[model samples]
Target: MKLPALLRRRAEPAEVGGVARLDRRTKNLTKRLHPGEVAIIHHSDLDRVSAEALVASGAGVVVNAVRSVSGRYPNLGPSILLEAGIPLIDDVGEDVFTLVTEGDRLVVDGDRLLDTEGAVVVSGTLVTTDVLEEQLEQARAGLSDQIDAFTLNTMTYLREEKELLLEGVGVPEIRTKIDGRHVLIVVRGYNYRGDLDVLRPYISEYKPLLIGVDGGADALLEAGYKPNMIIGDMDSCSDAALQSGAELVVHAYRDGRAPGVERVESLGLSAVVFPVLGTSEDAAMLLADSYGARLLVAVGTHYSLVEFLDKGREGMASTFLTRLRVGSKLVDAKGVSRIYRSQVKGWHLALLVLSGVVALVTALAMTDVGGAVGDLLLARLRDLAYWIKELLT
Candidate 1:
């Protein structure tokens, strides 16, 4: 089988500009990547969200130590990069992770990786839509296995968290008031950045009690908003976010051993430890509902089997059950933003400003000091008219 030259990029003889940015976790890499850099990643079966982020981040090239598209579930990431003209070198081998250090410069010419020291440390195959679609068609034939695996994971999640889902037990206590107010829970999931951009108006107008789950806090900060509360393991959160005066809630295992708690204490900031079942996002939703939030709006939430699988969970039992529990009050970011727009608009802002100026003029006209100032202005205008007539004569 042969692929077109357009489908695969050939080696460029010129030494191009690229600083290697490496990380095993695709999400972590996306957070740090900048434009014109080469991303050295180890994401196998990369999801669309991660791929989109990479493209948005403007990485010139991506060299993966594992398969970008392993013919699993029609992953659209590779296809997106292909459409955007981004080069993705797949399965360069795990040894590349060690050989390439952060900030190390590298020249990526087709399948070859040349270090600044002039050593070819890694190489792999170039991926294109044609290649991915062919592989996706083959992987689709094995869809039954994926479905079966997904079902088993769901069943296990339902069984283990039956009590919380049914009886509404183990909900955490929180200080930030949520009763009768809109609560927004943010996760650092796929397309979260774009979702937040769309929700900017809603966020400014309603000022919902903002909650960030782990790296989500950084996302919030990056988007020019401060989180009211941060809930997650300390592993991914930035120290600046912790000290940003937002209330901190550390997600811990049910047994009470919280690694994030230690990190918080080390940073000399006090945080409320939430020892609960499932993920931090689940706890955030439960907290909002328990505290009497009128509506719970969510950003970066994953609902599909592929989304959960991308998170590397065997099953999304906890998240699935949590969604079931958070039912009526919950709304997606897009849905809430659409609703909020009916009441908030650019013209409305212009009207408000116009009305404010009118009110200020009316108040000045009625005041004693304003009346004296107005008389002086009238006399000056008459004098100016007389002076203009004299000049004409």
Candidate 2:
């Protein structure tokens, strides 16, 4: 058993070099991270998903302005980085973002931040698996507090978003007709790829209206299918998806302020603006339901309490209200895929019976018993023909 971060011996300075990429948003930072670059971020309570993205990017070192493992929960982000052999410096302070420019060469000697001129720019506390693991344990004790906060946030959200619960949706008209049809709404969430893989058969058969929610459009594109419609803040989506000729709908604030609309228009593309108070997935569902879709299948949608918490959602009032409105038509693809089985078609059973008759005839022709049966069948056929002729006469 390793000692807690407090009890563990302080680590000595070790040199590591890279060009710095600084961002307040870890998601935005991960997108631009090149191989072997040092990533500087301001993410507090770094989650598992963000950590995995950083590791995949091959970030040499992470300089954090906020706590990486703040004892809020047993977040696996910091531990994953450490296990992947990525050095992490925590609590460097917000001023670091202002001081450091993107692409500036920097050195992280343990927690000491050194500039190109060899001057100490800033210092931080080094993070270790031992320290983060202990922090996680303590964070588990704060679960009740987290739950309370979540509940309060949810209640507040419900008060603000009561319109969704009462009114179905004022879904705008689109060229893609969805009435009385199955609509598949895809999201980039946990097990999304796997769930989509399992639903491949359903997808091919039903050919549902494919709606991608922000980054979910990229997910659908990666899976080799074009989205019929794309909806979201359009922040996390790529230029490729935006230009893929899919009808784009920008999710705007209720006050009609759309941050992503400008980006779309600047690219010489047109998109419809939808102002609503809910997640992108919720928007997709409401749109599908409002368009009179016969069924709604959600891919990678977060529904469970723990899942919402893991996703860092303070409240799920929108999800709750959206589900309430579209619950009857909605189905989670993952759940359906687990119980789905291939149905035997009429032609399949017909082919099976035909094969059995052919096999029986072939066997009969090969033996004396078979020859006798064949003769009897020929005689019966002749008799039937004679009787039909007599009836006609």
Candidate 3:
């Protein structure tokens, strides 16, 4: 008789050992992750950002307490980890958290998680490329249902926040003047670093109002640009960024419970509380648009259906509607970076310098001083030729 589904054996496991780094929050855990450490996280449907961070942290193996891919949507995180040659042990159960402490020397042999004593602490499915692909396919099949949910949530928010969406009534006022200026709102999302690198020229030339959404404030700081205004729930942003003299806008719940305000106050900083029902990215857009920004440029903001679903937030629905509201003047920086070749190139600068030198020479040649300078330059060349010839001989 065939075995039941629960009784089925997992794929043959490979043995890999490292000191375990445990954190229920993947983002927080990533901060402490060192090279060759085992990352124990509880992130379900792991998003791209967290996955990329883990990969960058040089995590040797990832052990998830919950399902990495729940088949709700095709999230790109697990695929990234696999592609980075990082082994992933999936659905190891939350008991692993209680069973294993931080810095425990654990060995992941195929499906079994073992301790230094060779005792099986837990066992789970060793996720391979083929297994991940199958899960992705199933996840893709359910995307349509997710779209329906997204649309329904959008409609509900539209009905409740029509005044804020249509007229920008509830947006808090800030000291930074955005009138008739370009505004760059960064979110530290997909390809944010690359996007920011390409936008350096744009940022330099336009000098747009810089608005960092949560962790994006640190992104800007890392890129060597100071944000003029920092907006978000204040959870992920660093204390350094909050104290960087940027105007702080606390994105609060519609009921006026601004949790971020507490953090800001503890840091001896004041902030403008903008109470609204949406993600901070949405609020930033609405704030920029309402303030008469001539152009709104977004970096690392989720736009596609898969991206919205990958975020795993119902607030993404608000982001969708917010994009539509600001789509007229808003430009996704990723697309801009793809098409926006810097107008200034090396050859252009070289030709400009050559032209300036030529003009200076021509102008000097028109005077008696020019003839003397030319003769002196010719004598120096002749002397250099003579020295080279003497050395050769």
Error at 133, model 3, angstroms? 1.0
- lDDT (Cα, tens digit) per residue for candidate 3, span 25-113: 88889888999999999999999989999999999999999999999998989878876778899999989989999989999888789
Residue pairs with clashing backbones, model 2: 364-370
Tell me the lDDT of model 3 at 6.
32
For candidate 2, report its TM-score: 0.76
Residue-wise C-alpha lDDT for candidate 2, range 87-111, written one tens digit per residue: 8899999889888999999998878
Best prediction by lDDT: 3
**CA lDDT scores, all candidates in order:** 0.79, 0.82, 0.90
Alpha-carbon TM-score of each model against the true structure: 0.77, 0.76, 0.85
Error of 2 at 239 (Å): 1.7
Q: How many clashing pairs per prediction, in order?
A: 0, 1, 2
Across 99-171, the per-residue lDDT of candidate 1 in tens digits comes to 8899988997767889777788888886655666677777667667777887777787677667766765666
